[model samples]
Target chain A: MDPYPPSNELGATLGRIRGLVLTQETAQHAVDLLAQVAQETMPNASGAGVSLIHEAQRTSVGATDALVRTADDLQYDLGEGPCLTAWATRSPVMIEDTTTDQRFSRWSGAAAEAGVRSCFSVPLLRGRDSLGAMKVYSTVPGAFDEADRARLTSLSVAASALLGHVQTSETSTRISSELRESLRSRDLVGIAKGILMQREGLTEAEALAALTARARSTGIPFGQLTADIVNGHGASGRRGAP
Target chain B: MIGFPHAEEQRALINAAVVESGFTVGEVWLHYFSLSGEVDEYEVEAYLTGLMPLPSLECDLLALAVNELIDDLPPRRRAPFSDELIRSHAGSGDAE
Candidate 1:
């Protein structure tokens, strides 16, 4: 049955899951929680997995059952399957008839050989952008009903929110690094300009103009010129020599 | 003729699979897989002819397509070739 919005019984479980999610900080831990939700709700399901995809490639972060692990591995290795489609399209993929499905026609045989019959995938998206996917596999046909789909969609939403936060954190880190580097470069640039003014008896603007001219003439970078000055310059302020 | 397996995976076959399923083609498709190793086409055809009861144009085409797929398979796995391949020149391979 689909477990959406949670009845009292499921509400308690959802509460527990939500509490646990609040307790963790790492993206990997969030992925594990998504897998746990899929596996717990779908008892007949053989495996549950979570994946992070960016630029068309997928990396699995967590797996709940051996079957799910295998499915995730196959998707990673094959690069085409329900989970791949879900992640790429940022939509839910329900493979009710795995055996007859042409998508399965390729991996279906191998997956069948490995004991999986049905698969359902929901994208973990960051508002129209798919950051990852959550997937569940079963040994029975039509195992994912409407209720299950709804339950998974909500869980996927929760996962998407967390994953979006993680991706944002990563972006913040990159921005901070660039800002630090920019600040450092400006500090060094100031010193180099000060050196130019002191040695050439020029104002700040004149020193900057001289440095720019030298940089252009020698085909050396301004940063390189400043570094050379810092390391005790040569006659032309080139990198090598005193 | 001279490319990776991904060259084949994105084949018109993807659309064909979507169109063929639950329609003209039956559920069970028997492929004569000859991995350039043990099995041969002649032996596979002989086996199919002997075992199957139905005889029609649809069956013939199915048999040919299956055999063609089997022939297309490399000595190695198909998934990696499909997965590992990228657009050689971001659109060059398809254009060529």
Candidate 2:
């Protein structure tokens, strides 16, 4: 039997976490829960932060105080901080002495400014695709241990399950946006279609067909076709010139 | 603020969904990269949107944006379909 009770508690917590992530319904609700989990489980950490990379860009929103938030934001904005590197490399990043970590070529200054004495960041990825990172900060050096990293890595798995949803939801929002823009421009395209219908004697569908075909055939695009129709009418002073 | 970021996110999600759907990430990325960027934005949008067949938060956001656009448009005028009228009341709003 393991002599240390805290280590056993950490393992039990990690197992419970995996089970929760496997069944959690949505991603939005999971973020807050994970924040709470980090606070209660990580003993030495004064605060926690989560940074997620959706697409190629970085988006990190955290639940820490002003100082840790500042440090985490620095890592996110510069893309050179310990947590980001840890997440990218899918390994444990330890800053035993924040004021003295030589590996942090550029991050040392800002971290010093943030008054961070030590830092640790772990990747939230399963294999190759990184979901994001879980970072913890402390005011004292030598604050973390191997058991802490193991527990945090398990936490990252749960966090990924949550982020996977945010990412998907975000993507869904983007496509919806493109669709909306398509619809918004539809009237103009429709007017262009209407113009083509009036001028070339084509129906709505036929006008769209003509525009699409022209885009394909001429190596131009439908939006350009729509623009041409509008601009051409404006230039020609023909009927329905607007 | 919205277009590029969101588009990129959707592409990532599409890759993930495909990975979940049982294809290799490298293969998918290679195929996606090979597609010409010259394709119409609408076509590319359709392709990405098609990859994930279910409605999620993005659909809601799109609806919100559309509703906002439609709401912000000036009330319809009784004027004829003249060039001046179309140019003047063409219903422009925050798209990007």
Query: Considering every candidate listed, which one attains the maximal lDDT?
Result: 1
The docking category that best describes candidate 2 is incorrect
Predicted candidate 1 versus true structure: per-residue lDDT over A92-168, tens digit per residue:
99888677778656677778778788889998888767788888888888888888888888988887888787654
True contacts kept of 1: 0.00
DockQ for candidate 2:
0.02
Q: What are the Cα lDDT values of the candidates?
A: 0.59, 0.57
As for candidate 2, its clashing pairs are A172-B58, A173-B58, A242-B83
Which 10 consecutive positions of candidate 2 chain A have the poorest summed lDDT?
A: A15-24
TM-score against truth, every candidate: 0.46, 0.47
Model 1's number of clashes is 3
**lDDT over C-alpha atoms for residue A97 of model 2:** 86
Q: Which stretches of candidate 2 lie over 4 Å from their true place?
A: A1-30, A55-60, A76-79, A86-92, A126-129, A170-200, A209-242, B1-96
Overall local distance difference test of candidate 2: 0.57
Which candidate number would show the highest TM-score if scored against the true structure?
2
Per-model chain A TM: 0.61, 0.59
